[model samples]
Target chain A: MHDSPDPGDRRDAVCVVGAGASGLTAVKNLLELGFQVDCYERETAVGGAWNWRHDRSPVYAGAHLISSRPLTEFPDFPMPDTWPDYPHHSQVLSYLERYAAHFRLGEHVWFGTEVVSAVPTGDGGWEVTTQSTGGGSSRTSRYAALVVANGHNWDPRRPTIPGEFRGRVMHSSAYKDPAVLRDRKVLVIGGGNTGCDLAVEAAQQARQVWHSTRRGYWYAPKYVLGRPADQVNDRLLKWRLPLRLRQWLYRRTVAMTTGDLTRFGLPEPDHQPYESHPIVNSQLPYYLGHGRITPVPDVTAFDGSAAELADGRRIEPDLVITATGYRPRFEFLAPELLDADEQGRPDLHLHTFARKHPTLAVIGLVQPDSGVFPLAHWQSVATARWLRLRLTDPARAAAVQQKESAKPLASWSKRRVVKTERHWFEVDHLDYLRSLESLLNEMEPA
Target chain B: MTAFDLLRFEDWTNPVPPADREVVSLLPEEDDGRPPLLFVPGLGHGAWAFAEHWLPHAAGRGFPAHALTPRPGGDLRAQVHDVVQTAASLPRQAVLIGHGVGALVVARALGRYPARAAVLAAPVLGGWSALGSALRANPGGTLPALVGGRLSLSARQLFQSGPPALTAEQITGYLSRLDPKPRAELLRRATPPRPVGDAPVLVIGSPDDRVVARPALDRAAAAYSGAPLMFPGMGHDLMLEASWAEPIDAILDWLTKQIK
Candidate 1:
């Protein structure tokens, strides 16, 4: 460590903005690459959103991982095989804790410390300001690079309907327990995996449940052929099967398992499989087939205790939940730093590297079909490799950056995703991981 | 594609089954920032070999030492999985020390697991000389190992049989606990795996090692470290043989002074 500097100008240190899975792994990889790192976390503990004790955490009591354990775990450090296919949120939290402790990542992290601002100093370094989570005066320090892993799920994105509801209306983030839905009529909006999961929970606790979706979607079962379905899909991708055949196989499997959506009085899928984000929910189909939950078209407006469906049908409910998803937010850094548009969606090169500033990267801003942790892990690995290349040979690193900047955004999934706000960051696991592997080759070739 | 890119997807989908092996550890009263050391014992042995001497010896000097008692398997991949899985469970990344066939296991496992550093002690690795040495030292064991049968090793053949020889009861107690391997799992005809990335490696053994020759250790050092740190007059199982403390002291010196 540098002895002392005026206001601690640590030229070798990289400032990381979170201690979540992405941030912790970033610190580990950076340290492995011989770079000093100072990670700041707003919460008192690590695991970020996975740690349910924190107020910003989106984890709920009924939550089990939608993706199976194999596809979800970090590549270097896996969850024990004793853990079931889909582990509970508490288990995931413990796994993250184990990861943090094993790698000694906690020592590098500054708990209860939050980065308030990070501005580029025009000399390829960033001046980062920090403040304690509790009331405290802010401190500023300068570092060589910045990695923004302040996750994207904490912000609430409650879509505006025509009129306000007279009764209770809340975002899914607030619905942490089944007690909120007990003996109540609930209306849940959106068709994301979380939406399906919340609806499934409502089936157990609520008096009546209604699920509203903007468009009919293909629902994949959590398991296929008695194995985790994602594993089966990954195998098909590894073999490089024809896209149409894979999609057909996926549709066939879902049909064989759950039958057609219309058979259960739900609308037929409007889009092809893989055109949007996957919703792996076998339980949602069971609840729907058992007539515990009713499927309806998207809600257009809220009138008192009633939500008017787009098909002109109205359903009255005690609680209306807007599970419309979250928008990625980076209020500390300038919008232009991340190349974020008006909607605050970062236009990162691989949904990671910032072309405007090669030293800047934003990890965990993706919504891949597989687990987010492994993707974040690979992203950090690639980013650390790039930064080390810069440290050793700036001219070559700059040339690589120039070549990479001209390439199109690396979001190449097998299926052409519909350009929608919800699927803005959607990526196929195989395609994204392949792109990252090739990108890593560019910085650290074999 | 990088080795990791191909293995990444496979490990995620169809991982190696979790290894149900035994682990023995020794801890220091005060840690002086030394990395943990994990030892994989040679063939026809259990973790008891290291737990007997090297573990307490290393830990006494403030290093956390561990040993893996791998389950007997015919395939090399199974042993590699055992080593990698046990290392991942540790509180820190360990300096992996492999002995005899365990050295080959550690080498292959580098493709899958990252280590703080590595040491191949009395390595049964590289060249036809290793087979030739094994043939000359114990024709009875080598002939059986070559034909898919367990190698027959008398206790004296492993430990130092000259000065500080093991007593008859000491020999019998250790022999009874051996985890013997079949011919399919021995070191020769091995596929070369990815090398350890950037971590410093130390190849330390003895020229007097009964089961391996000087040329074999030199080749192992050639593959990893630039030069072999030879501890002469020690047996093949350096961690268990007579003059064991001398080799371990050199290892501790290297870990503390050389790597840092």
Candidate 2:
């Protein structure tokens, strides 16, 4: 950890937005890195979506873990062995509470304080706009650096469908439990985990279900050889092999054991499999193998009681659910400050600091093939060191790095970055920890 | 009447309409010759709910009507206070008409205040009558949770949100003439206590109320020792349903004859 920030220098505070698993880790790292940090969360409690359930908000409707508990736990904390293979929503919340308490992060956090906006002051600092529900107060604060830790999923991406078929249509985000779907013939569009989960659950209640996907997608189970696929993949990614060979070997290994999409009713894809979805972690493939969920093709149109697929098959449905996906939205970020791709995901170099914005950094935006909690913690630690080096020993750091074969930590003002694909299939959690520690080590003055 | 019944009163306080200037002015200038009519709305409803339903009904009968909506804490005593406040503001005397949860409020008010008379239309009673009973029993204990959980899939609940379930045309017409206050103040009058005063009381029931349950409304009328007029096809939301005007006119005619 670097030298602690002067508590008296209130202006040196690093504001962490969101108190989710990622945000909490970021705050913990900032504290350990010797930076004064304050966390702002939109929810009244910690744990983000997990807290939504404990808070009993409707937003918690049907929350399931995309990543299993064993691989999902923080490095310092392990989940209780008594828990089932997959933890329930309540159990996940309990674990998040434990993580927060373990780090003593509650006092540093401002609950019910939503970060409405953050803009660069052009002086290498951030002006953060926040609304605090605790005392009905709205205020803006200046910070040395800002961490945008809010996760990018959960917001609904409305699908384009023909206007004629209107039974009762809502996004999967709006779906709570399947009780409201009793005796109804439902059509679930999208073969994503959410779509598949809803299809399987609804099949138990609804008279019939038609799950529509663009094409067949491979279903990877939560576990491989009695252990998590993530755990196995994590080890391979960290091995000392050529990046190209590793990518090829990773694909071959995944295909050998994971099997085909037919286990889930999806036909083989005609083209090479590249997921447009930033994150493709789901237990749907496992459910599909058990005949719990059925899959179909893309939807062409809907006419009242009937849905027409692109393949020319038509079926009657009493309800239609769109489990499409969510687009990344930086509603609170300044327009000029946003770095975005054609797909609307904020275009960030290394998926950390925005290419356009210097003092501003985004954490937990990547939907990693592995769990995000560990990645977010490492990113926060690297970021805290990056900020502290700029404030303290930039000249000495540049000279020391110029002498070493490995590149020195670049100044935030001069760093060049691009959006790198998250190599979840090849990542080891421990390898990532060591890599992040090395990056932090370089930032330290010799 | 049981001690529980004797302690209840009727509600006769009406709500302030929404911010619609046209509806505010549409209210006819107060007439000194006519007695005021106080309307108490049903559960999960506010004064705005009756803006179109009761507004025209009251106007057609040469009466000025106001609806009392539920507030955060709607119990029997709080309901009685609303009636007293409405009566003080309006003409000296007003006939109190409560429907569903509103009926319990009106009953509580009449037992406590000097109202002209009281009428409960399809008062929520029976095994499902836990709403009023729960409020009277535990005022501060998880009311939103109970109501939100139980009233899961009602038309009102669905339409209460964005774009509104009601037709856009209806909103443009009546929503402008509504006040948010009285409706904001009413709560679900959960159970019934008998009216304390010997005020004339009339209870109305419907055979088809899957939500309120017909047997529950029956027990309420039976407990009052009052004969309830039964409407075979009417459901819980009597005021908004078709053929409601006929039954409402019948009640008015009966009221006029009894008053004379």
Candidate 3:
């Protein structure tokens, strides 16, 4: 409740809004560039979505990386090769912890501190207000820039099924343990990664499991021929093979691995491969083949306790888990600053820089087919580089900004993924990373 | 990555898996604020080389000195990964000092880890340069090595100490500690990774070393954007000679300028 700016307020520092994977990387990169950074995390610790200890974390007990370690690790700080291809959630948390420790990122981070509000000061600086997560008077400070990395997966997006179900229903964010599904008839909705994962887990314990999806997805196995499939898949992507050839190869590979998912009584994909977010699940097919689970279409409506599907089928389930994805939420900054659409999803340049407010940017907003951390790393690197230019050479920075703002942001991939709420921030991992690398080259080539 | 880059890569599709590493250390009693020095050994060699003299000398001079050996398996990238990991495991940012095949590993590791500084001793760098030197030095030994056999080094092929203190018996004692059954490094054809992070480099080698020729030294130094600092009369095992303190002292002196 200061009538004037606090004596401690400083515009020389950059404020990073989270201490998760993206936030830690941002702080590290900024500090490496000699930028004074003050990172604030609402949680008591780091790891963001990967840390199940946080209330907003989505990681379940059995959560493991769908993206393999190589593509997932930071370009500079790679995961130890001794680790498995797909490390467990605990491994991811420790990795983030070690990264913070290695870079001394924790020194810059203010744990248990939440950014209350961020308002643009008239002179291209941010007046960021903060409060302790336990509730207290807000402390106001001024920062030259704000890097919002509060993650995109915590805010659950629930699908609105008509009518009310008497049975227990929960979002995938709330499905943290399999003990809840022990003998219950579980209907896992949405054929996304989370949905497929929950479905497979349910088959091991549930009395009967029904997987419901709006449309079929290309179920890529976690592994292909004893190697992590993401690494194997990148062979074609790295080769930059024509899309048709790549798709044919992917189809052949998937066909060989999982065979036709439709043969398991699941709906076939309506769109071409790469048109939807890939669902990596090797066990779904196995469970389906073993007759432990049933596949159904979208839930049309819920009548009493019965769930009616799009295909006129009815399933009475004890527990209905919605694996529908999440929407990005940035409450501290005003919506207009992000150039956000009606859905509150950001329209960031390369899923990072803000076109409208140059001082306001977001990192790790992207959902890449591969792992999200390395993309976050590169995004943080780009953000740091751009910020350095703004501080050292304002003229060149403004010129670059002008050009970037005028280019009319294009889809991250050559071919656009289906325009859906879930694909709001989806990107072709290779294509987007290549673009970021090229941009970095243009900015300050290594 | 271009096709040339792809060919140079072990496998862009299936990256060489990183391997385990064993590090031998000799720490100073007090921290002098100098960066740690990590010693990467030559092919068929282990950490025992640097652990013998350089590690103890560097530590005595108030630097955290350590030496690493790639756990006797995996490809060249794995070797590089082992070095990078060892550097990271050090207490502070490390000054990577690689000898022979390890110099090549350090060159590639520069593409990944950003060491504070680098030092290459009698580096096996350029493909043709290394091959030409190896064939000329001992064609009979080089023939079996090309087909994946260990290119065993003769006592003379390794040691050429000019100092009176370095007796022939002492040279053989040093060689005795080496892994006798170690495989020959045939990765001289590996693409030289571009020096990254702007770390200053020091290439110290001997023109008299029969294992690596002067051309290889020049190529390694130029690739890292540095000049070769020649120490004549020494052999490939720079740290195993009677003048072992010379190269480590030179490196320590360079660190004093570049670091503190």
Candidate 4:
């Protein structure tokens, strides 16, 4: 571990990594709170995951917001009412660009510049080294605070299958167009939202579409009662119903809307609805029922073009699309800064504040069931306020720090811990939002 | 692909069957001092059609809202009885809001049971005439929907001239939830009588609705001696459309005046 720097000698400049939704939000909030901000983005544009044109973006040609527009858009700057209940990926990118331009966040960001290393300085600040993608000279700068908003979707979590398949195999991140699956026998692994979406897409064009899942996931329709599902959930929060009742209602609603999953040969959900992130695709079940797509058990092994299922069924797939999801990686930061808990998640308070470094905060690291934009907005607000308080009022900063430290650290893990690497940072959207709101209230005092 | 050599542990847990109720309450059943509201969906739709936004908003406004899914394969009269019984079983005399065929059911139920005011959204008035108009507008869709035991209209037909913000995924999701209406129900000669009883009616219509013609909506409103609340350039699915709040706000305002 690097030696600690003196707290009194830090500068006032703040270094924000990535120019994605979280980064742009941090820049706007930090600037509003009178902090000198510098943001770095590896891509040429501001929209991160929404930027379908960006090489690193995991969004495919048919990508759209899983959550509804009202729930996903920034509360302060909402998407137009004329837009559909759910907007496409291109529209989401345009919205993000509009947000950046509206807040003048682009001026503070360095496009095509990647943060190579972010090391803690001896003076309670950060020394950030950057390298331009154009192969120019590397530059190093020092700032009093560090904000990691690089996002977690860049690193693809590829699943391993036994034996070797000679057919084409690709991760979902590399998938850009459905034309690739045209007339090919395609097999999609994983039953998350993306996997189900890709399977449905392939069903339209592929010769045959087969979806494999290890476990059952609660599937939800994007719209219920002519409104977005997330928006309905948000309104239901006002009812102040007990948690059990709420879960029961959610399960009943889902069952009625989606019908039976076992009827379509899909495994029934192992846990209750809202226990983990439910698959919000409505087409998967419809396609399965119509025989356009076949649901199979987990893959046991691969033998050339023939793939063996756990139930001993063999399928000859021409193409394999792995929609297994992504892993969170921060190669620029020291490994010691992110100490993992028993669940392999970093031991950060509220999944934002670094345990050892008071000035270091991470925004948009959480996986919420609702739209991530609002959560990112609230997180940036809290982090910016806390950083400002640390400089102006040491006593208040200490009090806030003490409050965070005294609270139970692994409360979420204790509630419902799923033994999957993908669910390491999974959080119930409503529960996480309440925590973020409470933290913001304490930091801003209003 | 190289990451596959590692031993992976499989966590197998028993799957739990979901609740078996067809009716879903958006808010708790406990009375919140406001009149309860029962929502009935149109042909080919389940209770989820209103579960997305209307039920929650109405619930938030102090009205405990509930949605009912009419059992599949029932005749029109039987389905109407199912809806009426659901409304009657509520904690108190509840306001009935219905869409399309559901509106027709509410109109008929008004004559059979005592209730508060009713809001008919895109009501199918002059039953045969409305059906003719729908057939003319969607000949390719109408015949297949009826014969196939399900109704499946394209997203464009459903949300005509409305916001084009819905992703393809959402459109498919929305379309997948459209259940099949029984052929016997469609052929049954059971149109509700015009202006059944003296209950105040608020008829909602959209000019851009391709599924139900504007003239039919006007006639439906005229039958009840009520003014048609027209939302220009909107689609047939008013509750799910982009300007959903417009009709909701109108209903709330009209409900306030009717209560007074």
DockQ of every candidate structure: 0.48, 0.00, 0.27, 0.01
Per-prediction interface RMSD? 2.4, 31.8, 4.6, 22.4
Weakest 10 consecutive residues, lDDT, candidate 1 chain A?
A406-415
lDDT digits (tens) for residues A346-427 of candidate 1: 8888889887898899998888888899899888888888988898888878878887777766444344777788787888
Q: Give the CAPRI rating of model 1.
A: acceptable
Candidate 2 local lDDT, residue B251 = 68
What TM-scores do the predictions have?
0.94, 0.53, 0.88, 0.61
**Candidate 3 residue lDDT tens string, B60-156:** 9998888988676666767777777676655556788889878888878877776778888898776566667768877876677678786656666
User: Residue A77 of candidate 3: its Cα lDDT?
Assistant: 68
Candidate 4 lDDT, B1-260, residue by residue in tens: 01110010010011111223378787644655566778888778888988988888887776788888877665555555566556545655567888987887777666544356789998864556555766766677667755664455657767754354566776688888776553544545554543322358889988778767877888778777767899887778888876777888888788878766
Candidate 2 all-Cα RMSD: 25.5
Report chain A TM-scores, every model: 0.97, 0.80, 0.96, 0.94
Q: Quote model 2's TM-score.
A: 0.53
Q: Pick the winner on TM-score between candidates 3 and 4.
A: 3
Worst 10 residues of 2 chain A by lDDT: A411-420
Better candidate number, 1 or 3, judged by TM-score: 1
Ranking by TM-score: 1, 3, 4, 2
- Structure candidate 1, residue pairs in collision: none
Give the docking tier of candidate 3.
acceptable
lDDT computed for candidate 4: 0.75
Candidate 4 TM-score to native:
0.61
Local error of candidate 4 at residue A59 (angstroms): 0.5
Root-mean-square deviation per candidate: 2.6, 25.5, 4.2, 20.5
* Superposed model 2: Cα runs more than 4 Å off: A1-9, A54-63, A133-137, A235-265, A270-293, A396-438, B1-260
**Poorest 10 consecutive residues by lDDT, candidate 4 chain A:** A1-10
